[model samples]
Target: MKNLLTILLLTFCVSVSAQTTRKYSNEFMNIGVDAAALGMSNAVTAFSHDVNSGYWNPAGLVHIEDKQLALMHSSYFANIANYDYAAFAMPIDNNSAIGISLIRFAVDDILNTTQLIDDDGNINYDRISLFSTADYGVTFSYARKLPFEGLNYGINAKVIRRVIGDFANSWGFGLDAAIQFETRNEWKFGIMARDITTTFNSWAIDEEEFATVQDAVEGQNQELPETTELTIPKLQFGIAKKFIYRYDFSILTEVDLNIRFEENNDLISTSIASITPSFGFEVGYIDMIYLRGGVGNFQNELQLDNSEKVSFQPSIGIGFKYNCIQVDYAFTDIGDQSVALYSNVFSLKIDFSCFR
Candidate 1:
């Protein structure tokens, strides 16, 4: 089973190398950051207002009141892959903010079986080794409030790094732009454009290392892989409103439309684009304790009986905040509503003012 898994993974790597522009490229970055946002099915575009906003909608960073730091960790695929995120944001002035964020997703200790069978045709377990595949993203964000009240704009400069052990590696860069607007009645609207400049990745494969795999596969992987990969643009539009009940209780609700310029099995699919709608809400008590829930990633799935059915992912979470420190937890499905096992996500946030 281990050797089979290695072969399958390597085949996938080779296949990916054959494509110059692929859908879902650098998808690890789209898995999202903060647990609070995940709990809400990533519907926080218009509602994000802290360091985590660096990933959700950078324009929301203008709402940060102080120096803030955020961290999150999650595991997927029965703990075979680990995802981590960290971010920091500070007010550049009363109307502007700057932030930075980092994300990493990795599958570690994968068996390297290219040499499992020695030259003498002996099945030698001792020849097997281990390696890892990892993807990393770093983003620098800036947001400024417009002269018009309640309007803000932001931009992100993103750098991406991917590695498949010592066999392959790539470097990528992209740009993002976002805008947020709030009404006097507290309604919020946001738009985020990812990879607005068309992210590009250039891969460098080690031919020497690949030769062993080529020999193992027999008649496959005879040629070097494609060196370039491109990721097209995607958009997210969101609207939200908060209702304050009595004096200490509140509820915030949000809806978002995620748009991809491709024909896919999304909830609303067309020849030019596809749209996936998401809904989320948060309930809070005394501004300290919170409960969150959402549903998103609607897709059409073919059942065993060859019937098409609509499926969605649901997530729930809880949060607590005291002084300048906050912690949150969420239970979410990472596998597009198909996997039975769910992932648990946890995140922390701190305000630097607490130290002063």
Candidate 2:
């Protein structure tokens, strides 16, 4: 008990002392995940014997009964990564359990365009022709859950790495700790602090070194610049409440105070202070038929542009559970400057312990 309290206090201290983002390059958390995307915020309150507990909330693992494992993957527009996550957990003596999670974030193939300029003193011609790509972050997480009375507490730590073509490559770590205060009678509360590492990694400008070379349509000989490390912060800390009625229908809501570190804000501020609240409701009975809907704000900036902010994409989803197997699906439209992202996604989650 003493050690648990110490760990919780330390996690909060890390978040308070971490340095935030200094410039461009924003970290995102809304890209993928079935439950949260579809708006099951109501059900996310408890640690059900399901796999998605890796993202929406990990502390729920403390409630699992039998041993379980699951993998979730999705194919998105332009071949961009929708989500690839895996997790497993087993009970430890009844009130405590341990689990592990792995999540990979990826982007679609991109064209790396370089302009070919012809300065003939009379007419200058410019044509962009190149191929490039951008992607970042690979995470491995470890979590442990312990129960106290009717409540549960959990902790997760993730190691992250980011890579974007020749622009930059940064590696860092993150930590999230949460407490699930609940009662079988009716109400529940949840609190979590994410990205406590404020990771700093090295980045090299391969293009900057090449920018000075004599437009020598013939001199491709100079080497690129050496990389330097930069530390950036991307953090989210939130609290939520859930009300389960008749032990079936539920309503869940969360209010998050988010702080982003970037070069600048194309929509708000380099260090913007914002509040994001999400809501979800579920309709079903006997765990056989289910339907859910949810909607929240999605960032519309690239690295740091504070000029535009639009919100209006409510999500909808449905699933079926039979005995020890279940299947899920959701539809969400996510986008940016390059193109409008339209996604009709499906998820296949198997919770073999479906009441086992």
Candidate 3:
């Protein structure tokens, strides 16, 4: 027991000291995948129980009694991009489980033009071409119940890939670890360390493709740096409580604190001070339907010195379940105004154990 506590303390210390100034190394990894969890503002680190938990907190995968598969899709950034995810989990025994998940985000048909010919000299529309930019990650996860009752631990190993048209490509690897505990009185707590080993992305850029504009770019006083990106670790902690009423209704409330260590000059340099808090609630009608809502990303208050509104992005969602299949829909907050702030996300989950 003392040894475990010591290890945890050391991990926390290392995470604090490993802060970097490199930003957006693997930024796409921060986008929440599952619609249900996003609708709840990513406050599920302690409450997640479905296959999608492989991404949120792999330790939650231990709750799966059988085999489950999940898929999610979103048309993000005002329909300018597409994001998709798929996950599967299976219990190995009463005490352990394994899972896999895939995430993809892409923006296609981007017009590639070195110079807008019409705006400059020629009127050649034929010079224009289209290409796509994409980011992808494959995650393998394992979870096991600890010897101590109500305690669980998990880990995730991931491979990340990114491409920008035919100009640049990057590949990287990362690992994540998490622990969760539940109390007899329906209270749950969890901690997740993302990119625990620090993800690194090494980019291979085609410099020849930009040779034509190289002198012009230099004339503009902009110099491109070498192509390596580092992603610092992010720590997430959550607490949740469930209230069951009668036998047909239940309500769960959860909150999470997120501390991200990055190389963002726009924010303060201290890891402990750069904290974001999120809150969420879920109400269930038996096991058939669910309603959820939450708020997130309000930490700007600290960076902005409270000069601007905290911009607490809010989301809402609903889910329906019957027999072996479940379907969910959510409206995730994406912008400042209602007209542009909300995006639709859909997900489907299936349990094969019921068929057996």
Tell me, by TM-score, which candidate is best: 1
| TM-score of every model versus the real structure | 0.94, 0.64, 0.85
Comparison by lDDT, 2 against 3, better one: 3
Alpha-carbon runs more than 4 Å astray in model 3: 1-20, 115-123, 212-223, 262-272, 301-308, 334-340
1-356, model 3: which lDDT tens digit per residue? 23433432232222222224454567778988787888898899998887988999999999999999999999976789999999999999999999999999998997655543554667576976777778999999999999999999999999999876665677889999999999988799999999988887777766654342342232322233456667878899999999989989999999998887643222233644367788999899988999999987763334445464345678899999999899988888755623344589999999997899
Clashes of each: 0, 21, 1
Estimate, for each residue in 1-356, the C-alpha lDDT of model 2 and write its tens digit: 23432332232222222233433222434354554335442234333334555554566666666766666566566555555666666666666667776666655453332233345533223343332333344443334544356566666665555554444455555566666666665455555545545445444444552342322324333343334333444444445555566976654454443345443432344444434444555555566777777655434443355455544346667777677666676655544322446556565555556655
The residue pairs in collision within model 1 are none
- Give the whole-model CA lDDT for all candidates, comma-separated: 0.90, 0.50, 0.79
> Which whole-number lDDT from 0 to 100 does residue 156 have in model 1?
97
Candidate 3, TM-score vs. the true structure? Answer: 0.85
Residue pairs with colliding backbones in model 3 are 21-263
In model 3, state the lDDT of residue 67.
Answer: 96
lDDT of 1 at 74: 95
